[model samples]
Target: MKNAKPDLVYFSGFYSEATPFIKQLRAEMKDVKFLAGDGVKNDEFIKGAGADAEGAYLSLPSPVYTGEAYKTFGDLFEKETGIKRDASPFVAEAYDAATVIIRALEKVAQEKDGKLVIDLKKLNEEIRKTELDGASGKIKFDARGENVGGETPVSLFQVKNGAFEQLKQ
Candidate 1:
């Protein structure tokens, strides 16, 4: 890195590994700009990287949440976990995933031999047929089971003053 100095460095991994790697990069190439994916968009990375995290850029596949329900959820989440909502946007996504599963289970699961049972095939079919207005956005899966609902604009953010700030692209 010292001999062949690159102007920009892009990371494709999670924060646990990124924190140390970024620290080393900052030490070696202080001027080089660092960029990473949504995997490193959490407060843990900022906390771990400290001041070195400043000026680093990150991207998320989904746009920053704008729904009113999500705003309430974010507030409650901050109050309960003491972590800012922007630091971890995956919370709503995870909730939506769990909700999909619970809804499917409610529709397909039945009592069998004094124990709850669910056919895997039926459950998969039900999950595939899901369509709900989730906290993140409209939840609908394509034929291949990929989420086909809502616009997936790639959201860009920068680490500044110990927080992730959304950057207008």
Candidate 2:
């Protein structure tokens, strides 16, 4: 099978499972292109696979740790945690989630008879009506409580020189 090599090999699993396959494939067929799922699109995968991780491709929602919009959050997070970590898609999603929840609560919470009362039903309605420009991008929900546009923009990246390089298409 090594002699009859394919042009592309794809791995659709977590970094733990994909890294070993990448390493084995690197030893067997160094030139074949490796495509992976979002699970292997992190620093841990690169660290685990070493040089064999280079030139590998993966697709992820949103740009990782890029764009001027995320500079403040990234800087503050690094300063507070003292841990420099790659900004993954989850970070943006989390920010948007928190924003939506807080915004909805603010709209539904009321001071009634010297007591703070929150209407749960109203909060849900507010959440469905949420529209805000977030670090990830514009966030708006449909009646089904899903992002109006369905999925976020997916960007393709290639591992180059031990770092993720976004491929502009």
Candidate 3:
């Protein structure tokens, strides 16, 4: 790599393998830029990579919430769970997913012999048609069941001083 030094080195794997590989790369090539996906955007990765994790770029394929709706959800989440909402980057997204499921269930659930019965096919269809402004931002599924209503598909983050900070778009 010294002979053909690239400007950047991108790793597409989990922290378990990426930590060691990136540490080695950082040790050998301090001048090159390092980038990875959400899999390595956690405290574990930073701890594993040590100082080598600094200045590394990470991408999260989910929305970053900062609006009032999110703030309200965060407050309630902290109160109910006794854990800060920001503790996990995916909490808002998970909450939005659960909200979507519950809404779908409400739409498709039926009463049969005093018992709730939900048709799996109808529930799936209702879920696919979901459109809601959730804690993580807009939630809408495309034809392929991929959320396409988010402000952006991927939020860029940089590891600075052993902490992941989301970069503004």
* Candidate with the greatest TM-score versus the true structure: 1
Q: Lowest lDDT 10-mer window, candidate 2?
A: 61-70
Per-residue lDDT of 10 in model 2 = 84
Per-model C-alpha RMSD: 1.7, 4.4, 3.3
After superposition, the stretches of candidate 1 with alpha carbons farther than 4 Å from their true spots are none
| Local accuracy of candidate 1 as per-residue lDDT tens digits, 1-169 | 7788889999999999999999999998998999999899888999999999999999988744788867877788789998777676588888789989999999999998999999999999999999987778888998889998878788889988888888954
lDDT of 3 by residue, 88-149 (tens): 45888888899999999998999999999989999989988999888999888987789887
The whole-model C-alpha lDDT of candidate 1 against the native structure comes to: 0.88
Off by over 4 Å in 2: 1-4, 63-69, 83-86, 102-123, 149-152
lDDT of 2 by residue, 124-162 (tens): 999988886665666688888877633466889999999
- Higher lDDT: candidate 2 or 3? 3
Give the lDDT ranking, best first.
Answer: 1, 3, 2
Off by over 4 Å in 3: 1-4, 61-64, 79-84, 109-117, 142-144, 166-168
> Which whole-number lDDT from 0 to 100 does residue 108 have in model 3?
92
Judge candidate 2 at residue 141 and give its lDDT. Answer: 82
Candidate 2, position 80, lDDT:
86
User: Between 1 and 3, whose lDDT is larger?
Assistant: 1
